[model samples]
Target: MSTITVDLNSKVVPAAQKIWIVHPGRNRSHIDTFESAGVVFLEFPALALRPEIIADDSLLRQRIRYSTAVKANKGFVRDDGTPIHIADYPTAADTDVSVHLRTVKHLTTRMMAGDLVIVPGRGAGGAVLFGEVAGSFFPQKSIRAAGLPFADTPVREVNWLTKRSKLELPAHLVKFFEKPPAIAEVGRDRWSEGFFDFAYDAYSTDARSWVSLDAPQYDGSDILSLVPPAELLALAVSLYRAMEQRADLTGLDYDQIIARFYDHDALAEAQMRFQSPGRYNLKDKDAKLAKWINGFVALALAGALSACSNGDHIEFTNKQAPNDPANAELTAMINMAGQSAGGAVLTKAETQAQHAQSKLGMSAPATVR
Candidate 1:
């Protein structure tokens, strides 16, 4: 069989940055390495792969399968020494072997040096550590004698950038860490990923910017130009939920979807305000515009947020959204807006988000919904 070699001295341009998850071992078995060492480890040490085999992904998987056949598995140790060696395969067909292969292979070959890894439940208060892969891959035992923590397994040098408490992050981000794997990648969920980028400072928009409840009133014309009030209110719902819960939303559905719209709209306005301040020059700004705008927007979303899409048009008939926090919030917004506008901003429950999108020129936002 053909073999490959890993060149320690080689240099190549790393690909676009990717975020990964590297568990801190089963029962925190590998937490020591993560806590004290500047590296991350993926433990599937059955193959004891050589430099050449580690370099060739196909060969590596083949070897992993081959090792699974060895009745006495040494890599997975049991509590007692006598029980330490056990059958590695859970099934005769080895149907579940793909995950292990994928994990090891990713650590050895697929993961570039610059890729980032998320090690959860580490540091004080079990903070999530965001670290970059600073060095190239090293197969099990190659760096063992080098005294690196958990060097007996597949190893990668990491430069931990920052750590945040699980409570301090978004709900979606915390939910992501519940996955049980030595290694995995965050899925391509739009909102979760967007929040990840935001939480990790990847968006260039500081996460702190989104943490506030205060939104400056926009001139009715200028703010409405960025996003129609109704859509903007929906987006605000999502943002408020995140800000209220300090969590990345799982999915932007119903009221959640409303929040996503507000987020984009707000981002557009923020850019205009900070990046191009001239466009944001407020003229006779209605200080309570937010109150009135949100009230109208809430009125629209209340009837249509949960409507099922029907071809091109949607039925906005489900209006009595009692006991829903979003509904409650909408009610408050409507009340506030009415108080500000010197009259009720209430509208008939006649159209859904789709109708609003089409009528109001709402930017077809990319949502996690």
Candidate 2:
């Protein structure tokens, strides 16, 4: 791993022209070490969460409260003007469904990928989400064929094989409450994987290629020029549900998964759930971990705002495994911002936040499992 170091000194590169240097990885020779201006270089890693696939169609139907089939129904005019009817939503029959979920996300004063935003509840239907939402939540589905033996190819090949796809129009319209042939694309570029990029096409003349990308569905090499409205809604709902579900998964299993990805001091406590270790109950462990993460987010936000200002430059370099208990990416971003423009815009919002926090008991909201 290469370390990233930023020289804030005015001599090396004027504070106004500070350069963030990163020693490129062996395989990443093309990546630059510095940027010249506005929003120069960015890298948002793709996240492929293993969602608890709700394949049980019956359960899904029950979750959505689908009783009447509504093959054909009639309605009467209301007192004022509108028409009212007790009819089943056409999407109730769809094998896939996406429900809009509203919740609060916890973000630090610094910018980081995969920051755990708090959603309100837990369990099935605690926070209803859609099918596209589920797919987008854990969008990174590994292509098994590419990873199999005999292919000592390259990471680029593996990367290329990891393209993302979406559902067709008719099915999407029924599910996401949108018209047929809608544009649906969101987040970052799946090809290179940066930030989420979503575009809409409910009002496009050409419904075929609403999103501007090379389309394989059509012939050889026709670039996307239009995006369908339904497709866009499906993409949005899928992303929303994926995020909501991810926030709700806080358990021994989740902790174990986190430990597998990055080691933490809490690993021993998490591992005890499997063996006859001590009287370490998984529930308490889960609560403590959740509380820990919550506090870390609070502290990081507070610290980052205290350090940075606008127009300041910060560099994030990997060092010794990922450590910054609060989440390395987050901490690095906070540190970077702190070294620059006297904290971010949130510093100004602190007063309003304090008022809200005081009204709400000042205790950080607990994440639902």
The candidate scoring highest on lDDT is 1
Cα-based TM-score, every candidate:
0.43, 0.17
Q: How do the residues 1-369 of candidate 1 rate in per-residue lDDT, one tens digit apiece?
A: 211111111111122556688887665456556756777765444456778876765666666664543323443443354333223323232445667767876676667776767887843357677777786765543334122233144467788766656555557676777756678877544344433432332111112112111123333455444444344444444434343444533433434335343444333223223221112211112212232233333334444322222111211111222222333443343333222222111222224433444433332111111
Give lDDT tens digits, candidate 2, residues 1-369: 222232111101011211111111222222222111101111111111122312433343332222111111111334455543333233244523332100000001111222211111122222211111111222233221211222111111100101112221123222322222111222222121111111110001110111111112222132231122112222222222223234322232322323333323322222111111111111111212322323222332233223333433333221321222323343344444333213332353343334323332222221111
lDDT of 2: 0.22
RMSD of each: 19.4, 27.6
lDDT of all the models against the reference? 0.43, 0.22
Error of 1 at 139 (Å): 3.6
Please name the candidate that would achieve the greatest TM-score relative to the true structure: 1
Instruction: Kindly report which residue stretches of model 2 are placed more than 4 angstroms away from their true locations once superposed.
Output: 1-297, 300-304, 308-326, 344-346, 365-369
